[model samples]
Target: MAVDPRGADLARLISEDPGGPVVMLNLLRFAPDGAAAYQEYSRRAAEFLHKYGGRVLYGGQGSTALVAETGQAWDAVLVVWYPSRDAFSSMVADPGYLEITSLRTQALSEAVLQATVPWPGFGES
Candidate 1:
């Protein structure tokens, strides 16, 4: 089987950044036993991300606020920012972050990752 290292990649990418925004579209499958663990891990992750100057601008459950229609009631949503792409890359290379990978994987049944970049619009904030 092909081993997916995305969890590690995302964690490290956000953990070492000096400050910027990274938005995560969390699609956590509902599992009562895993909710607390997932949240705990996310909190710790936020701490690490902040150390890199990253900030989670907002995080909440999706309702009519999201663009896409999803059947699952995702546990939560997360948005974070890192200094730059290079800073994000640096975090991905850090070996120390490998330890937290399982915690994230264990707490969720599914997750989707997407990369977003800003687009300038006329008279639009």
Candidate 2:
């Protein structure tokens, strides 16, 4: 139930940079009455996200899964794109960003922060 990334995690993310923009997949499971707090955290963290060249491609509450096993349905999902993994790393390391991270920590019982790499030439016409 790790809700946040550690220093080593951040380092590995940068060291394993796959080049180009990185889209992050965030799967969140909230603690009891945690959704409101998480929303507040998102609001406060927007400035940092923009400053680091990160943007939310999509974000929404999870619904009944048409195809999935139990324990796989998330409470929320966020798809965010960053200019690069380095930008994400730097954003998480910022002192200001760090200050409000506790809000996220308190809000989620479990979370998955994953990076998604686009297929080579997949998006090209």
| Stretches of model 1 off by over 4 angstroms after superposition | 1-24, 30-32, 64-73, 122-125
Give the count of colliding residue pairs in each prediction: 10, 0
Lowest summed lDDT across 10 adjacent residues in model 2 is found at: 9-18
1-125: candidate 1 lDDT, tens digit per residue: 12224656667655655454444344455344767777777766665676556666677765564555556456667665666755555554556544665667777666654445554593266
List model 2 lDDT by residue over 18-59, tens digit each.
789999999999999999999999999999999998999999
* Weakest 10 consecutive residues of candidate 1 by summed lDDT: 1-10
CA RMSD for every model? 5.5, 1.0
* Candidate 2 displacement at residue 41 in angstroms: 0.4
* Residue 80 error, candidate 2, Å: 0.5
RMSD of model 2 against the true structure: 1.0
Best by lDDT: 2
Give the whole-model CA lDDT for all candidates, comma-separated: 0.57, 0.94
Give the CA lDDT, 0 to 100, for residue 94 in model 1: 56
